[model samples]
Target: MYEYVRNPSLIHEGPLSKARLPVFLVHDGGGTAFSYHLLDRINRPLWGIENAKLQDGGWWDGGVPAMAAHYIELLGKVMPEGGDILLGGWSMGGLLSLEMAHQIALTAREAKNREGEAGDSGASTPKAPIFRVRGMIFIDSIFPLRLAELVGPLPEEPVFLSAEESRKMKLKDKVNLNMTHARMMVRFWQVPQWKDIPVPPTILMRAKEFVSRDSDENFVDYTRDLRLLGWDQYNEDHGHFIRDLWEVNGHHFSIFDIKYLDDVTRKVRKAADKLDPPDF
Candidate 1:
């Protein structure tokens, strides 16, 4: 794994008001997270985590597991008296949030084990607070491991990128760091059996349309199937993990537009409110 100092910086910090717990949002493949600032912050503080190498002149040397481990440690200090927190991520960030939640659960397990050992010595369970995952919001994240199962093996052409995306990507090709983050994303495909960890309530928001003028002919054709954008089989085979499937107002890329992003933020807060425990 590529080693770096305490660099994957936390980019956002909210009010000290513990009245409504904070939400930590992770960055997607492009590796920056400022867009989350657009989220509605009615009663919550929003925090963002971004890859240091992408912006700070280094590179992510490892895979998702390593990334998760590093971020969890940072969060442990950043929110020491950890309490319930809502987790949200866009695209690749969604998969990241799940891994993070699993990591948090691991910490809880370790805490429980320590208390067990103390109890044997006639001591009570520790009351120290630790971070807990209250809920998750996935903005069109499709885990790698499930892609094959959801859509069958993809064709050789892949058709993963639309014309607009292809055009934007050509520009990024000139930047080495962009390619680095792209490569890092490929390593996130494998599924880890995070056994024994509870699945927090989740909501997945998808785009209303899929298209672009410059999109490949194959991609344009692929869009016709819709499958509601590859969600039909998912709802049938893996619906249990997600509590709700939200078809938002914009397409995958446009979901972040101020107009639609506001809706996304509002719904996230509403859902988080229901899942998060009362601060009392």
Candidate 2:
């Protein structure tokens, strides 16, 4: 039941050209594609992967790897044959994007190895990959941690007791959907060590205000851990190349708010433009 928005309108002026690869975006935890309506400001093809769970009789029961695989299949259908692609997402969607990039890289590697073997064995190799991820963009996304740490506590009164009930419930309430997504995130993190793999040219648009101000006595800054553990290691291991981080105004959610839409779109477009084909 997942819906794909093919010709999404741009918030600012300018039409997307067919020559360039479209940027595929995953929805935030609220499972709302409209949440990213502001990104239309970027003068490029934009595709939003609407959450299947939000639709009646849709399927999405929490598992980052599974979710990534599902999207990869969908991506193949939309992208041109052997074309380049850009992947990005906000919040929980960002984490999903990272995973998708990793899977794409793995698949590409496998294809390359197959081609090499074919060359050696005098066999016909496939012309090119179905699609290659050119860049990855993360908007205020953090590395995964325990659910209890991320969200204080689970609600005592369950909104949708069962998947069947969730399917039946109206998707009008954003709060309800957010709560459901939060639980799914918790479950996603509970799975055994789902670490991030090295991706293509990447950029992280961090919300400075939110991470700086919002801190309870016991709150641990996962973003700090991301800088130290994820970003730092990635740079060191990859020769200090292919990654950029920019601090933007507003809180985590508000960074994508209408007031900062122009700023956000500009940064994203800049990052996407900077991407180069991955060197095997």
lDDT of 1 by residue, 127-188 (tens): 55578888887777654543333332333321233456545654344233443444344444
**lDDT for model 1:** 0.61
Off by over 4 Å in 1: 1-18, 56-59, 121-129, 146-176, 179-184, 216-239, 277-280
Each prediction's whole-model lDDT (CA): 0.61, 0.61
Q: What is the per-residue lDDT of model 2 for residues 1-280, given as tens digits with 9 covering 90 to 100?
A: 1133342222233243334556777867666667667674455666777565554322355456777777777765554364677888877677778777777777877788888999899998645435677887877766565535555655543343366665566776644556455555545453222234445677777776634544441232455445532456544665443378887777666777888877887877776666632222
TM-score for all models, in order of appearance: 0.71, 0.73
Q: Show the colliding residue pairs in model 2.
A: 11-40
For this target, which candidate reaches the highest TM-score against the unseen true structure? 2
Name the regions of candidate 2 deviating beyond 4 angstroms. Answer: 1-18, 56-62, 118-129, 146-148, 154-175, 186-198, 211-242, 276-280
